[model samples]
Target: MSTPELHWFKSSYSSSNEPGDCVEVAVASAAVHIRDSKTPHSARLAVAPSAWVNFLAVVGERR
Candidate 1:
């Protein structure tokens, strides 16, 4: 009948509230979700737990 609800929140990694560069995250039992903070209603990217960890590893390497 109706869509489910998601308690999305801004990523802690986002240091400042300047503008533009912002991302949000939501963790669920099945997947880790990411969406643009500027457009919360837009499409999002969902990844498995292991995949999320691997992705962070790569991002950490670059930074």
Candidate 2:
């Protein structure tokens, strides 16, 4: 089966002036998708919604 179209949004950290240094996010069902803005058509990393939250928490704690 083919993948459905997803509504993607740019990361807040992504600047309009930047090209390759960008990230896009999309949420589908219970999974979150992350793709490189420069190669959006390529494969994206998928993570569980809960896992994504945990990942963000770790990143936040490190910051």
lDDT of each residue in 1-63, candidate 2, tens digit only: 888888999976566787678889998887999999889899899999999889888877876
C-alpha TM-score for every candidate = 0.76, 0.76
Q: Provide C-alpha RMSD values for all models, in order.
A: 2.4, 2.4
lDDT of 1 by residue, 5-52 (tens): 778887766757666678899888779999998888889999998999
Candidate 2: list runs displaced more than 4 Å.
1-4, 13-19
lDDT of 2 at 16: 71
Using TM-score as the measure, the top candidate is 2
> What shift in Å separates residue 33 of candidate 1 from its native position after superposition?
0.7
The collision pairs in model 2 are none
Q: What does candidate 1 score on TM?
A: 0.76
How many pairs of residues collide in each model? 0, 0
Q: State each model's CA lDDT, in order.
A: 0.83, 0.86
Q: Weakest 10 consecutive residues, lDDT, candidate 2?
A: 11-20
